[model samples]
Target: MLLKFSRNGRTTKALSCLLSEGFKRNARPQQAANLLRPSYLLFSPDISFLRRPSLLVKRVVCWLSVNYQISSNSWSDPMDTNEASSCLVEQLAVDPERQSSSPACPNDGDEKESVFKGLGILDRFLAVWIFLAMAIGIILANFVPNAGPALQEGTFVRVSVPIAVGLLLMMYPVLCKVQYETLHRLLRTRRLWIQIAFSILLNWIISPFFMLALAWAFLPDEPELRQGLILVGIARCIAMVLIWTGLADGDGDYCAILVAVNSLLQMVLFAPLGVFFIQVISGDSVSFEYAMAAKSVAVFLGIPLGAAILTRFTVRGLASERWYDQVFLKWIGPWSLIGLLFTILVLFASQGRQVVHQIVSVVRVAAPLIVYFIIIFFATLFICYRLGFGYKLATTQSFTAASNNFELAIAAAIATFGANSDQALAATVGPLIEVPALLGLVYAVKLVAKRLGWKD
Candidate 1:
């Protein structure tokens, strides 16, 4: 007897056939239902299956055979009982190969895979690429000698043209990936405000003071380096934090919101905070250009953000959301890594000689920074995790809290203290140390999440 079962007004042919064939074979209802339990648990949204396992089995089994059309011959009476059961099992089995190939229907294994699995080779070995880029930049600076000067000659708004281009390229793709549509809902949520408040406390209140203490503890005699470290601490991250958050598989929408908030706060507070930490607190006389910090935020953040908004809305408007997500995003995604590497090359090349020659100074500066980054990242991560923020938001909060606005710090240092000053050198060392340090944190965060059972 042919039976018909419908879910949400749609008939399920495969499920009907399975149940009819099972009953014809005189199979127990429980046994027939058992075959579909795994599929049901994996895919079905309905909890009714939990209470009425046998009753809902037919509806739940439909998805298994929906993708592949089962021929009538397979279900013909000419087939033996064993043959029929085998045929049903074969048709209903979830094929791993097909599941991986088809992006439309993702399985549990896909969800469990490493977040970094989707990234390209360049993104996977990001630390290695960054080191190689830094090495090449150093070699160019030392051997070619003129290459650094040539690359550094042109400046747009006091940022090297090469560096500016790399920053824009790196940041644009990342910003484009932000879920702008969800921002309104995110803004409306009280959790977002709580997170923002936590960020402000950690980044503005705790982190700067912590770095100042580290700077003093590590570099007591080196006043210039201490001043630079304090500046780094107070500036707060607006740029590379997004890249780090993305690499760590953090929530890009939340990271973007934090970044925007930090940028605005940095404009208002960076100069005063710098003065407070360096001069008032550390007893170092230094002039910090408020305009320099504002301009750095505008150029580094504003330009790429505006471009990303235009690109995202324009492409999404012209094409379907699926096309934009699956096609345009895939095409532009790799450029973020490319830009990161390029920026590293240009940045290190500009200051390569100093990095090489002033190894002692670099070490002195790096010691405190390394300590500060590790402590702040783990502390913030732990706090957020305890607060039940989940892996994505916790990782985002940690990176944003731990990272500094190196571009702004370096620009302010140079504009205030001159290009060749020790303060500028210290500011430059911030990224040199930060790149590898934060890259390490990315891996650490993933491992910790796995250990803590933090599901994505």
Candidate 2:
């Protein structure tokens, strides 16, 4: 019953008969005809189809006839079989709609929604989750004493196997999010240099001096605790700040530059900074080895960073860049939170008994660290505002400046001092105070940005 009109003539005759049949079946002829709007049709005529015109026409006619019968099958109105056949034959003469009904491209909304949905409730209340992790770790340490030692068995330089793995996992996803191309472009931008200078001034000069002073003020009698706090201050953050920066809707590209710069600077300056600060704060000649500092940088920052770069390059080369960012990285993003939670649990579990016994000393040590985070966050924000940077860059600078790389500090403390040393204990208390405080700062930044009408 399919119509195969010749290219020579009868094409218009056949189409008119199809429209007449449609007008008879549909209650509103205009509305039914809208489905076959010829103006909206997208077609590309192939040379082969042109050469085999009868074959092409006949095939299209058959396809249209089948589709028409399927579409009209549920209708209650009855028509003669011959009349229905004539209508379908006529309808086949109309041009086919070549475009797909489905969307041609994926949307950003879908990607973001998928990622956020994947996170679930734990991600939304991350600070509460960390607090719960601390409690669980403490409980494990107190009751299941053997578990802590067993978990700590694969320890290297006082850093437990689980903690090391967690640190790497926590860092990799954030590092992978950094676009090297954006970093390269940022190098040429004046704002990048401004943020760099700002970070260096605070991280190397101002913050170290401030932390040394705080340790002296809070733990004047506890020389070991003072030394550890100072070490924590000297080891500027390169990894965890990315999480805080993202939370504050900060400029990620600029943050990545600062992170990279800080990582390299830590290798050269960390030992000197630790030695100098501990000497000044504790009034004792503190031993700090350059090899230890370099090893920390290599393990904590270098390994994860190298892996991130390799993964990014391989994924981008193998697939589309859009797929890598929107799909692959989106899934990888949650590993950061998982690593953080696991690391916290292990830290508290190992140190839980010790933390309970020396809770007073931990609190005293934490006082200065908490104050340092607050003062440094505001100080950096004020500086950025004075520099006329937007909220995005300002928050990025604040987070980079305020956060410390506690992983490096913990590793250094355990390597130089014993695992059971007060120095290690003080380093362990850092994230307990730091995580909650930074989450508050993130909220504050958002509020301030909205009040000032700053663009994210």
Candidate 3:
């Protein structure tokens, strides 16, 4: 059944069931009274509705958000969660608004604040806690200089041990945030591979040459500085990329795929790229792949991800989501910060003596990283817009492609070249700049969308 009405000679249709039997029936008289008042307030369009995407995208996003997103608010709390879920499910079941056409959907504007509107620049900056940890890692490694490797050649627990611990701490809230099944669904997304292409092209095909040129332009004589740019350019920063994408109101399902694929690809290809880059720029090619492969297993390619998967299985259905949020995420967010601080202290203990020597080098590397980031940022933004993608998708594409995979980069860098290698230093610095830079980019994307009057 349908209720058809005409306004200004244009006709609109609403589901008859909604008008006859649900929330509207209870409030029909009250709603009619407001319509009779003839005041514009009763009829004003929701400005937010302008920014929302086509009905189809919203439906898919709503489904994913309901079933998978980690709830972070009072409305999602235990006291009313079942009822909320039921209501959302009911609205979705009807799908009163078809995606292809503009219609007034019952599901629209129900939340007090859209999640995208809730996040600000500072939160995105905080997402880069790992990047800050990495910077401290470099400072400690360069100046303090630990007693040489006890376990393997060039290993820096003497410097990096604390950084690793801080990284583990940093992973807590993040791990808590992850939903493995949600990630799986995202993997099935057809858009995932396309977005991956954007990132790979940006990081490997485009960014490297830019860095190579920048290194020649500014630090032409220094092979160390040149090597650093190559290392940083090759590896991508996985965790932080998702954080920015989420902040930009991008589809979380797509962002999840970005995380998993980048993690795997970095292990397989990052070493080869690092060697090629170092050989190309520094003209001193060593056996870069064999050693880098080992570090990949120890750091991200193998252990941490495997551990995350195992933890998911062990905890499956052990407790309600409400309990998990209250007990787990609440605890992990703060502890992750502690893990970061402690890791900095340990890294300082190992690498602090050399920190003074690396000061100039960090400054040198920042110039190219910043330029490459800005160029890619707007470039992706332009292409995504031209392709007619929504702000959410465009923003995600821009950031995912713009940022580096620092974890893989740093691991590959150290494995291929000692922590002191200018190349290794470059990878460490990518996150430091990327964290703050992406925050600024997030704000820029939001503001630009607002200015262009782009929506849907």
Q: Rank the candidates by lDDT, best first.
A: 1, 2, 3
Number of backbone collisions per candidate = 0, 0, 25
lDDT of 1 by residue, 177-225 (tens): 9978779998999989998998899989999999989988999998988
* lDDT per residue as tens, model 2, 412-442: 8888897899998998888888888998888
Candidate 3 residues 1-456, lDDT tens each? 123233334322322222322223222222222222212111223223245445344444443443332223233232234443443333333332441122223333322123343233434345455456555655655554443232123334222554565666555445555677666665677776677787667656776667667777877777866776766666665666655775576665566556566666776776777667667546776666654553553454235556655665565568665556445554445564465445544544344444446778777788888888899889989988998878777887788778776655666666667767776666666666776787778777877886787677
Whole-model alpha-carbon lDDT for candidate 1: 0.78
The residue-level lDDT of candidate 3 at 33 comes to: 25
**Cα shift from native, residue 44, model 1 (Å):** 26
User: Model 1 RMSD to the real structure?
Assistant: 10.7
Candidate 3 C-alpha error for residue 75, in Å = 8.8
The lDDT of model 3 is 0.56
What Cα-based lDDT does every candidate model obtain?
0.78, 0.74, 0.56
Query: What's each prediction's TM-score?
Result: 0.78, 0.73, 0.63
TM-score of 1: 0.78
C-alpha displacement of 270 in model 2, angstroms? 1.0
Q: Which ten-residue region of model 2 has the weakest summed lDDT?
A: 98-107
Q: Which residue ranges in model 3 land beyond 4 Å of their true spot?
A: 1-159, 182-189, 280-282, 312-316, 325-327, 334-359, 453-456
